[model samples]
Target: PEQAEVREIPAYIIRLQDEDIVAYSRVCPKGCRYLNYIPEPRKCSHCNTQRGRDLCCCGFAVDNPVLKCPKCWSIFDLARKGQILCGRAPRPPVEFKLDLDGESIVIASLQERIW
Candidate 1:
């Protein structure tokens, strides 16, 4: 069978093991891609750092439950509405309200002011 083409979505959806769904913007607040690679424990492909560097994206781990920006090393909590755990980002990533309709998830509205 032929493989289906993979297209990039405008946002990121994180489904926890408990069936809870959370969504956030793909664009990082620091003007970089939020998650350009498969998130690993304390590993960021963009920063290419193995050591514990605060200025690198090597802290966005699923076990740690945070999303780290590769450019500025901003940390965002995945459980607490993408709250800023730490770093230089002036604001958190824009979150989108989602509604499940039958088999599809719809973007209801923006949770934060864009402007």
Candidate 2:
């Protein structure tokens, strides 16, 4: 029997090439409940409804490394501590320190680098 290696955490998880786990807040800081995830380059569905502009939240994994906001088009880099690549986000998303115990993952502390 094959055991499930992937477990869902409360936050948005990104598994790196080195098997390192990085987590971020799923909620966009720009006052939107739209959950961010790894997706191909395309126009955001939510933003598209409001405006006729094609906005991209394209960034996930090692290949594409920026998570753009669907609402304001704010871009955040996943590689460099989730720093703001561009756009008006006030600050980067909140990153949490994770710890693995057996098959369970726990959030140790909240990284408050961003306001």
Candidate 3:
């Protein structure tokens, strides 16, 4: 008689709620929740606690890092008012000159420098 051997399988952490399957990286640990930073890291990575309310003051480190104000250290919420009031106006179109050397032959000329 031959003995049965046990096979090892990869373990996965999954949650089933209302027929919805949510999967998380098991690498962190047995228990952990995703921390939403919104404009940045809103909670401590280890504790997963809400550090502070959204004051549009404390800059988040997750999204649009360049949009943070260095002086105040907060996320730039330009969309709060329903529109952005910053940015330069559009520039005027440039005009070009062309020279026809011969029949069916076209030559284009552009300005080299602006004075």
lDDT of 2 by residue, 2-115 (tens): 244555554666765556777787666776654456443343354455343434444223354456666676777666777776567777788888887777766778886724
Model 2, stretches more than 4 Å misplaced? Answer: 1-10, 39-54, 57-62
User: Per-residue lDDT for 1-115 in model 3, tens only?
Assistant: 0132322311121222233222211111112222112223234232343453333333334322112222233232212210111222121111123333543212243323242
The collision pairs in model 2 are none
Question: Each prediction's TM-score against the native?
Answer: 0.66, 0.65, 0.17
For each candidate, the alpha-carbon lDDT, in order, equals: 0.65, 0.62, 0.24
**Candidate 1 vs 2: which has more lDDT:** 1
lDDT for model 1 comes to: 0.65
**Between candidates 2 and 3, which one is better according to lDDT?**
2
User: Which lDDT value does model 1 have at 9?
Assistant: 60
- Error (Å) of candidate 1 at residue 48 is 12
Per-model clash counts, in order, read 0, 0, 2
Ranking by TM-score: 1, 2, 3
Q: Which ten residues in a row have the lowest lDDT in candidate 2?
A: 52-61
Candidate 2 versus the native: TM-score?
A: 0.65
lDDT of 2: 0.62
Root mean square deviation (Cα) for candidate 3 = 23.4
Candidate 2 local Cα displacement, residue 15, angstroms: 0.5
